[model samples]
Target: MSRRSLLRGFSGLGTAGALAALTGCGVPAAYVEAGDRSAADRSARDKSLVFANWPLYIDTDDKNTSKRPTLDAFSKRSGISVKYTEEINDNDEFFGKISPALMNHQETGRDLIVISDWMAARFVRLGWVQEMDRAKQPNVAKYLDPQLSSPAFDKGRLHSVPWQSGITGIAYNKKRLGREIKHTSELWEPSLKGKVTLLSGLDEAFALLMQGDGVDITRWTADDFHRMCDQVEKYVKNKQIRRFTGNDYIKDLSTGDVLACQAYSGDVIQLQADNPDIEFVVPEEGAELWAESMMIPNLARHKSNAEKLIDYYYEPEVAAELAAWVNYVCPVPAAREVLASSKDKDTAELAEDPLIFPDDAMRKRLAIARDITSGERVEFAKRWNAIVGL
Candidate 1:
């Protein structure tokens, strides 16, 4: 899954309606007052920024435990002290923690955060995050992938910016299967009965399965969703699927407990290094091209500092360095060239990997799944959880 994190649910209700009345729970109006920060207000803020992100996401050195050179360099050059914290473990958990603060119009104590685009869309819709000033992010304005610029959720480059990207595709043990897997339907093949796994998380699992049925992910319908669920029900009854999982699917595939499973492109990159037999396939049906985006929370104290830090990473050379260690899809197209000129052979070779800089062939097979709307979340989560038995 692209780690597209967001929550959705039914609109007309009693509990939800009461909550809605208290905090205007439905999607908030798009940035009318949200984007009105002046240059003076931005400049008068502190030179420090607080960033909240997921764990095990950035590059770290094995030898020197205290130093994050990239971050350190940014601080040195820009005089911005970045207090980076890996406080996000799960989407729903983090939302529960911060929503109360946002509901009361209080600061969430975070200047910036990196979250899956699906979840980012919720913050964008709820007006919990502020619109970024692209003028301060000159490199970002120039280098952000055109494909990610205007998601259906956020119609412009106004609310969020992609931090890194990945694809939701197939990862299988080539040696165990003795054949390459190329399509989503192949997971249900008779020979592979009880040898496959799907993600249990609704936000992470839904779109790729939908695409298996040849559904257009950009505009998938309820009928499309139901059809996929029906197929899953049949698979469950036939015992063709072992079980659903989160990141544990990686361990299952590695230990040979399962021969095949749905996988994130970024995870496959790391797994392939340790076990060369593990192969990632871009299925013929299509895959979700997703990103964990960066956004500024509303009433943040260091908005300008956060914008500057965002642009620093946008520099192609800087982006390439981070991509080399992280191994996710690089959203900056220009970074490919920067990577190609690397002093290290291993780094330069990353420029040639189709997964990182997807070629025309692979690009044609990727789609950004339409985000599940807030009105659809509750019922959808309920049905999806029941299917996965979560």
Candidate 2:
């Protein structure tokens, strides 16, 4: 059985709607006319495509950081050369860099870009991305995880396909804590009090807390949220929670300052490479699954070629190659078999790691919370930010 998804909430900044909310920049009324969203496909004429993604996000040669093998293979197979750039670091900064052109209904000068699904939500709302031609992407339709499709931001995933996926769960030092944390509520156990930390970001913390409340987070309500806030606030006042945190929770967990904390699955996987005592759990209640996705900006000159590249990566062999390096949840489950059969001991070992390939029991506990709408964002952020003291 498949699992539910978690907050399609924004990653770095608040909802990708901050600018749209503040200035009404990409409000529905401000969006480009639907007819204006497409630029003529120029894949035939250009024969070259540009893709901008986050750093270390794809497979590369160990000795030569400049060389990317999977993209090279695409260039060789499809004869569509790619100019890949890892220029995006933060979602908001990249948004500021390219929003001017997209808002003006001009090409963003690149054919493809990857960003958190929440940020992609803003582009979809603004009519800044083209509806993908599923006909050209057989591999994507066949291999894209069904759970990731039809997010509130892009129903049926017409505008985005996840590049990689990760979970927001709990990580702890089992030896220091002298126990296993089996559920989100366990963070508040008296033994762990003042040694536990929750994520400081509203988007980051809300879904897990809601799950801990026994709410079905797929349809969690505003009341569910405020009630969660009431509990977290109580924890704060009682010092049950040491403090809310960002990725900084990693260091604290590492140093024994924090015995347990809410954490990203990917970060804990890397941390365990150095310190094996650290443990990551998909709580008995549930955890959030998020993705940074790929989309073609509106009016991109190489839409067809871009679509082919997206489909190419979805092929299990290709996804496995990328998954081996990135170590995020493999969106293409078929990739697990490929990795399991690999000759390299390290690569094959990844196939069994539940964080990279969640087992059936864990899958049931993963939930994708609905994203806060632009209106709800203003209201929710005020309440949550105050609690986190942001």
Candidate 3:
């Protein structure tokens, strides 16, 4: 089904029913904007596209680490100098850095930026980003993942494009667990006490936890949230969870400090290369599908150039190059063919990896969570922080 229709289906639910449904389920509800689309100032000169992304996200030439051949080729072919910068270390910190600029009607010194969708929702809600002109991006409209087209955050192609996708699943060191864990409930079993970890970031963590109780995350309600909170309180009281973390969860899982913990499919792919014993599971209940999306910030001086750069990456060859290096979920449907053609057995094998292509079996177990809106942030953070003692 089209993403819009799927989300619209849930719009019919009453608030309480939705919450009750979401309590312990993994599916996230659809987000509908409560107001009109924010208008953008369209009269601006265009040339260079300044891009802000997370560290190590793009494909770099192996021998020449400084060069991103795919992006460089785009610059040469399209005559667009991409002023790409790696400045997004933490979500909140990056938000703080750019909030003043966005609030004061100044340029964010970036034409495009990549951020997690939950954070992307905040920008979209506040009208901090420019609406993309899809006519200029036929590649995106044609090739982008249909499931991600109308996210709970951006109902239409009004704001962002998913740069890559991943799942929040259970990752465990099989050697440490001495048994395979196939579901979320396994983490809560007494044997795993103090041997598991959760993501500290509220957005990064919650949906999967909610899933353990069988709460349908798509239509989760306040009561469901509270119940999940209460359960986490118990885990905290017993010190069953080692601590909440970010990428550090990889470190703990690798060193055997954590037997099983919430993990991103992309990171686990890389982690497995170093330690084959590390395994990822989409718990029987369900898992959250998340992505870091690319958007044009408001008041960018190079909108056309930026659009060109984005379209370049949409090409299957370019997308495959990126998918090969970064090891995240590939958004371009056609890239799977490119990966399969690779003479390198490792690259060809990646084409068969469910984490990358996400076979129907894995897709069935995945859902995107409800994004915390600007108004909801403070209250959500407060409640979540109390649980993690952040």
The numbered model that scores best in TM-score is 2
lDDT of 1 by residue, 53-166 (tens): 887666667798566777888999988888999787666567666776665567788888987788888887777888888888999989998888888888876978888999
Stretches of candidate 2 above 4 Å error?
A: 1-29
On the 0 to 100 scale, the lDDT of residue 359 in model 3 is: 86
lDDT of each: 0.80, 0.83, 0.76
Cα error, residue 374 of model 2, in Å, equals 0.6
Q: Which regions of candidate 1 deviate over 4 angstroms?
A: 1-45
lDDT value for model 3: 0.76
lDDT (Cα, 0-100) at 50 in candidate 3: 79
Candidate 3 lDDT over 153-243, as tens digits, reads 7888578988888888889999878999988878888999999888776777789988888988777777777888888888889998888
- Provide the lowest-lDDT 10-residue window in model 3: 1-10
Which digits, one per residue and each the tens of the lDDT, describe model 2 over residues 1-390? 011112222333443454655457543224876789888788998899999988778888999978899999999999999999978866767887887777777789899999877668778887888899999999989998877777878889998999999898899998887878898888888988799988876777788889988998778888998999899999999999998776678779989999999888888888899899999999888888888899998889999999999999999999999888888888899999999999999999999999888888888898777876656777888887777777
Query: Which has the higher lDDT value, candidate number 2 or candidate number 3?
Result: 2
Clashes of 1: 9
Q: What is the lDDT of residue 211 in candidate 2?
A: 90
Please report the TM-score between candidate 3 and the true structure.
0.87
Q: Give the top-scoring candidate (lDDT).
A: 2
